[model samples]
Target: MASDLLIAQPDEGPVLDLAGDLSLVLPSDFPRIVKPFAIEAHSRMLWSELKQPLTPWLLMLGFEDVDPKPPWLLPGLRDLQALLWLAEQLDHKINSSGDGVVTVVLPPATQALAMLQLARQGPELLDSLWDPLLTWWTETRRKLSHFDRMLRLQLPAADALRPPEVWRRRLQTLSTCLNNPAHSELVLALIGDAARWPVLRRRCALMPLNSLPLSRIVLQGQGWTMIPLSDSGLPILITARDGLDQRDAIRQWWGSASTPPPSVHWGRGDQQGRLTLTCRVFAPGVEKADLRITCRDQKLEISALEQRLHIPLPEECHGFTPLSARVKGVCIEIEFR
Candidate 1:
């Protein structure tokens, strides 16, 4: 028997009247016994009662239908149109004050699913949803003004937010679906500017070693000084200027000095736009003294050269070592041991 359902006012109590035959059945039996009638009834009831003041009663009824249903059992074409109309109306009210918090009146599960479906349709709807939230956050919810905070609150499911990072591995992915240059530019504009993005700024601040301009150097000998050819390939070059008394000592050291310097080697590694320079020094009967060196953007300065000569060495090794190095705005002492 068909039941005549009396839906009361939302803020009011239970139904005031019932006028048709009643057939109470388990919710599981709703799909079989009702055929398409249940779906039609659900949609019609929602639309007809939505504008009415039946709040608590309608809300309870809507919450009862939350279950896995066959796709064909989903509300028909006309019902979807009605659903969209309701959504658009609710969205308008939420966004009216330019605040992001839209007062969505739907069963909780239904509300989440609707938002997810809207997000999947296009970035436009996503933007519409987000823009209002952003405005609200900026004007009222100041504590949740940041993107990270907003995302955390809105996207509760961890699995849904994993696409951006996972797809960013490829340039095409970033350009096509994740962060297109145009979209990135818009996001940057919204967040103030590129300067406001600390992460992007940090990446920009790194000046490639190869891009640094070259500077002059003076290499001194016994009675004359000569400026040798600057090697752009090697990041570090040590030049020594000896006093008259130390000239002979310097000569002996130069006699044994390898043309390319046994201490120096060069190659490339994982990072792009940079080269690696490796240095090693080993001698017999040395006192294991520490090496002191300083580097500027375009030049290297060796101090306490006498100490570097006294440092002992291991039998064999392969790696890069930095002798007190300084880039334009950075300093790093690197030793891969």
Candidate 2:
């Protein structure tokens, strides 16, 4: 069974910030309780879903041009560094100023980070800061949960990431690079494997393995519209919560669920100046379809799938020759090259 995506909301958790306030400490009125959080980033355990592949059905959440890194994928290193840096600055001020004062305003994430740091040392010398530090810890935890729980709850969105099950079986086959999920990045490893698929390889060539683009299907007044994130004109890989594949027909199929365009397989002839072009035909608004092949000097029709259209080329050409056709109002090029 395919697993549904769980995209994290934007307004969920606050990000940590430490700048001029690094030298500031909470006043006496602040909270005095603190909770525990691991200093290490548990990527696999906490953000397990992010390890999934960049499939057509998945949506990438972070790295948006306008947004910060999503909270779920948030690592403690930054927050911990911000808290420790502020602590160091405050310590220096306490030593130098004789009678020092600091800013009292900060977000809960910072307050939680401060409480963790304030518990480290100099309790006797920093007794004045204790009240605010502990109080902030208690208050912050009241909303964001204790440290471990806080990390657990901060999940990143999966709108641009496909579930692992989508390729689990194929990955287990040991024939492709995906044979080992840990071999490399999920997207890059899949791209390495896509080198074997002519259609997918063509799409993969549009972007580097590390730079997978994202697309979305947004709802208009009544119908849904697919908007591509890239302006490069490469095929947009649409993965949305709603709408059928037919709804976004104008978009080039670039993702896992994308269909291969109609194609033909040329069979070897028996020295009779006759070769068979086996065609797999998919067309617009028809249950059954045929191919209309044309070259500079001749044209022919292939009406059957596996057993049809025994015809000769203008000069028995070798290599791929570009042939054009129209299907479902879209111009489809039949050459696999």
Candidate 3:
């Protein structure tokens, strides 16, 4: 897995925080001196480019090996040699580390520039770095969006030392610093603020309301409450009242929505080695109706008693052909090769 580091340029200097679990695979005799120098250089280089006092940056680094016995063209070989000579110029001792064939988690942006500086170097180096960095940047933005929405919706208590205005200003500062904020230091600071603000703290105490209900079991809380999943599998908010039988409250809440939803399960492989998908529809008023099942455009459709269900086939099920479809009891079984 690629390792991630968040670099925040505070007044003192750039602070590097590990975004995820840090498992660095260094050479057995890794040159400790070079690592710090590379980090310092990269940090300074990035900070200068951003030109902001407190900006946030993210870096992802991973190692991979190109195909063995690669066709090392004359230019490619020269670029490889230039990399080694550059290392030597830093007065750093070089050692035969690992297979020497595998790409190391070298410095991120700077290393890419260094390699791409070679006019005739293969495009593999830039490609390997660009793709992962792009993907990581996108995913990081998504996480920041979720966090920003949460912070904005839940305001701090008025009694806190740092008022809502202060938080708002801080958030604004962060927003100015990062077009899309996911800075580790800022995120941690906001979390710490949550602990200090009573109202925000209470609001941040989220319960696990997104659990699947098994069998006929229903969750009963301080009030008569149940959490049911929506059609898209997102958790619906709980509705409850004090001093009520949970089951009775559930039935009242269910009301028109009490009809059991159709469920599809995978059965064992048949003698012909084809997998079977069995859907059970035991809703009231639909038992006597004829069930028609069909698949089109990678979507499975089932219709009965004026009700229709559409299920998207997972990626693993793609290219699978439906061999047969039959109804037995409440189940509509479909075999796929």
Candidate 4:
């Protein structure tokens, strides 16, 4: 059978030899048909391997070998152009939808520019011009609309807002559109500003809230008492007292403990009906962390480093404390404490 006789020689670049076919012809004729078939099969395999999203540039480079006069070259070029066009469309859609617009638009624009450069060097050059131009026009319109919105919104801007660098080469289009230097600079400035605004806004938003001086304080709920500790005169000290939920109290007191403490031995106290809590204000980041606690009928304040905190239980009290505390973005712990 032909299948049994066909042998592929790897070292010879995929040569397939057929012995059974064309017995009437000389042995040299065997190579004529088999070698071409092997080369075609190899080329098809290579093309299949090249058809990956990450390898478009490599595939484009391989297209350098494609004959400009070949019937297949035009269709293949059209397909590649279609892929690039689709990518451009998807990129615009993503940019319009608040996706990473800068990342989406800039790299593809650069790649299109490079492809255009390569195409200009080749025989069928004009065919290369249409795809990049379409992409550029579509992207530029979207960018301009975005910049207009940013200017209206008083948003910060970046550098890409002007007519694309590629526009200069299209003098006919530029002349028809009346491209003046003043107009060009203004558009460019707006595009640049718009591109940079989001990053700047994000940085500003992530900053810590402004610190404020402590003023007058008051107890907001019943069954809760606020006590003022000895103020160091520089920092403030305050405490609150309420009926204790043991789990909540421990959670509030030791929420920062990465591991369980050896034991939390508490001293017995008289139910003077008042649970006295002590909170000593430490310097921000140095002292015990702040805790904000709210019960059904009371609120309490406790510190992070304090070993013992007094929580008063009132007769007929029906409430539990919910504690929450945040240290900027570094840590936010909410349990009982």
Top model number, TM-score: 3
**Model 4 quality (TM-score):** 0.14
In candidate 1, where is summed lDDT lowest over 10 consecutive residues?
Answer: 1-10
The models' CA-based lDDT, in order, is: 0.28, 0.30, 0.34, 0.28
lDDT of 1 by residue, 132-174 (tens): 6556534543553475475643322222222222112222322
Q: Global lDDT for candidate 4?
A: 0.28
**Runs off by more than 4 Å, candidate 1:** 1-83, 91-101, 105-111, 119-337
Q: Provide the global lDDT of candidate 2 against the true structure.
A: 0.30
lDDT of 3 by residue, 108-220 (tens): 32233334234122233333534565566566656666665776533222122121232233333323322221221111111112123332222111111101111121222
The candidates, ranked best first by TM-score, are: 3, 2, 1, 4
lDDT tens digits by residue: candidate 4, 225-297: 3222222121111222343323333234222222211111122222366443222222222222334333433
All candidates: TM-score: 0.16, 0.17, 0.22, 0.14
Q: Write the per-residue lDDT of candidate 2 for residues 1-337, one digit (tens) a residue.
A: 0111101111112112233232234233323221222223322332344334332212323442322232435555444334433444444444565431232223332243233333233222233533555565456546655653656643322322332332223222211221222321111111112123333322232222111121221111221243322322233333433444333332223232323232233433332554433223322112124344554444334332222232344345434354444333321224312
Clashes of 1: 7
Alpha-carbon runs more than 4 Å astray in model 4: 1-26, 29-34, 37-40, 54-337
Between the candidate structures 1 and 3, which one is better when assessed by lDDT? 3
Better of 1 and 2 by lDDT: 2
Q: Where is model 4 poorest over a 10-residue stretch in terms of lDDT?
A: 183-192
